[model samples]
Target: MSTYLIGDIHGCYDELQAILEQVNFDSFMDTLWLTGDLVARGPRSLEVLRLIRKLGDSVRIVLGNHDLHLLAVYAGIVRNQLKDSTTLLLEAPDADDLMNWLRCQPVLQVDNQNKMVMAHAGITPQWNIDTALQCAREVEAVLRSDSYPILLNTMYEDMPNHHHWSEELSGLARLRFSTNVFTRMRYCFPNGQLDMICKDMPNKAPEPLRPWFTLPSLIAENYSIIFGHWASILGNATPEGIYGLDTGCCWGGELTLLCWEDKKFIRIPYAGIKHW
Candidate 1:
């Protein structure tokens, strides 16, 4: 059975289907790993969620920033934006089941046998694999618990901005930092502090800032890391063992799927569907 790692879909259901077909993905045989942002921006958010949810055990997903935002909007903790295409998903008859399924998803997935780790964004440089796993479980517990709305309500702010992880960090502050690292981080200072403002490609980014993967980390030294979120990179080559899969399919680029056994990338260009 082949294992395929797909970049962010962002609600581009048609493109997702096309790429899966192109790869001859078999739900019963091949395993599909998604880099989240499963809904938003593009058309048919509802359909995309439904299809992935139906895939069940064959699919593995880590929640993206957009997926969290969609949950917040569904929980009435935040308002849906005009540019977002998730309203249909929020209003769907199976919205509750879908949201619950999403809430139960983790922020980090590790395949020890393959020595690979997947997160929506890259793992923080400050944390080792064990620490990252612990932090992910911390957030996942809250998300799967009755207190999930509390996290959804308080996680929107970027606190301790541009700061590194601290042992002293506790309560919601700690959870928020972990959440950002797993789902929103892009650039970080050489000292391992996060820099949330810059989204430019590495060369264009101002001095003292480097992509998170460039920073020294125990995790990177070991497992191969697969992530999405930074669509601006357009699937450009990154440091060895680091994979950036988001190719901006929702913004008129291609949807990318990495074939794990052979490390082949199968791309399906956007069909130019108008933004919702």
Candidate 2:
């Protein structure tokens, strides 16, 4: 009954299977938590989505930026990138079912019993746990609604890149901010506004731009925050209670999994096959 948390899969189905087999994961018993980006960038995104969907109730997932992009592409809100490997998934027989399931997936998941919270990127420092959860629900509601394409469309519209969270923000602006924080955020300004551009490692980041987790926040003091999206970190050492699990498996790095109860990490190296 171990709970396992794996980083971004990014369509690396073979490595995902290898790591799961190495842990002897039993879908009927063991619980698996995924950091999302379940598709794109690898050889077998269709297979990856199928496998995770087949895992059923044994798995928990938070939607990543890539996942949202897949939804937008599926809805014809945006075109699929030439380099994306999700075309097979889009053409699959169950594409509709898979996309519906994915859109219904929340951007944030909290395990009260385990005292942990997970998002694809990470929570903003300006948001307390309650506010974060509320904002997540707001976006999740939109994604799960019939008007979901509206959100998928509006989220990509050219707006101020540095729109800080505010109690007064409403409508599409509010949903977009919440979505970006949950899926695209990496760094924050000293005043707590999101820095969406920089993806460098913390030390190399320009001055005053700190990793979101490094900022002082109420959630960091209370529960372990698990996230992916910044593959540059490559699952390196982070501050206590902060877990950056994306090991860049799609970029020829390793796929990493953490056994939550014991904090043991299991890593499976990429096979170095170029899928894109």
Candidate 3:
């Protein structure tokens, strides 16, 4: 059986299907790991969400920032400008089921048997794999609880980039920190402060502010880390033990899928709109 890891789909359902065809994906025999951002910014968000949900155990998906934003929208915690672009999803007949499934998806996933970990963005330099998993569970528990609607109210925002995490952080602060690291994070300071404003290519994020995977604290990691969420990298990052699979398909680049067993990238070019 072959295992595949795909980058962010961002509502590019056609491209996703093309890549699956390229890989000859067999739902019964092959497993797919998605780097999240399953919906948003493209033509068919609802279709993409339904297709992945239909895949069931054949797929593993971690939540991405866009996915969380969708949850916040569905929960009535916030109204996004993307309302026009996302109306089809929010108004879908199965919207509640889709949103519930999405919120329940973890921000971090650990596959010890495969010796790999998956997060939508990248793990904090402050966390080792085990600690990261524990942190994920903390957020997941809250997401799965009765307080989830209340938590969504505090999910959106860029301020308060807390570098150090402690058990002392409960309520909104802790959940936001966990959300940022697992979803919105890309670049970070050496001291682990998140750089939320910079979404450009790695070299353009300003010096001293490095990609999260390059942090000195993470140099000792022995297992592979798979992530998406950095479309600007366009699947070009070659950092050791780090895999970036977002190829910017929503912005006219290619959809990328990596065969876990052989590490071969299967790319499908976008044939639709060139700019979003």
Candidate 4:
């Protein structure tokens, strides 16, 4: 049996199907790991979510920022942004189930035997793999709790770019920063300040903000990190021991699939859009 890691699907069901065909994915013999953002910014969000849910234990999905946002919106804690693109998802008959599944997903996953970790965004330079998993669990607990709706109400806005963790950051508000740092984060100010605003390449961020992967004395040097959500920058390439899978399938780029154990990659070019 082989494990495959797929990049940000972003609701592109057709592309996902095409890539799965390329890999010859088998439900019984193969397992799929998704880097998150399984829905959003594309046409078939419902279809993709349903397909993944149908896959059940055959798949492991680490939550992405978009997934969290969808949960917030579904719970009525947050309003829809980006031109009501998620409206259809909210109106779906299985919306609650989909939202529940998304909220239950962890922000980080580790395969100790393989010395590998997967998250939607990259890990913080300051955090070792164990600490990152611990932090993700703390948030995951809140997301899974009865207070989740209350937490979602507070999930908006960027938190302070400081590196220190605070216990006072309960529920969704606490998650906002963590999610951004681990999922959407790219660059940061030298002193461990998060540069959440800039989405461009690492070189383009201000001098104070360096890409998280470039920080001095990174902790996860011994393990390989797999992540998506940097489609605009890394595309479907593996850099060093870090794997970036988001090929911007929803934005007219390729959909990427990587075989985790063997490091084999398959990319399906976008016949729909040209650029993300």
TM-score of each: 0.96, 0.96, 0.94, 0.90
Which parts of model 3 are misplaced by more than 4 Å? 82-84, 161-163, 218-220
Which parts of model 1 have CA positions greater than 4 angstroms off?
220-222
Lowest-sum lDDT 10-residue window in model 2: 154-163
lDDT of 4 by residue, 1-276 (tens): 889999998888888899898888998999899999888887788889999988888998898878877887887777787642677888899888888877887888888877778889888776676667777887788888877776556555654633344545554555666766666777767776667677766656667777776676355567888889888774533458888889888888878999977888898876654333
Better candidate by lDDT, 2 or 3:
2
Kindly list the per-residue Cα lDDT of model 1 for residues 109-212, writing each as its tens digit: 99998889999998988888899999999999999998999988877776555256887888888888888888899989888888878888899999999998
Q: So what's the TM-score on candidate 4? A: 0.90
Query: What TM-score should be assigned to candidate 2?
Result: 0.96
Residue lDDT tens for model 3, 45-85: 99999999999999999999888888887877878566326
Question: Please, what's the RMSD in Å of model 1?
Answer: 1.4
In the predicted model 4, the residue pairs found to clash are 252-273
Of 1 and 3, the candidate ahead on TM-score is: 1
Runs of candidate 2 with Cα error greater than 4 angstroms are: none
Q: Least accurate stretch of 10 residues (summed lDDT) in model 1?
A: 155-164
Superpose all Cα atoms of candidate 3 onto the true structure and report the RMSD in Å to 1 decimal.
1.8
Clashing pairs in 3: none
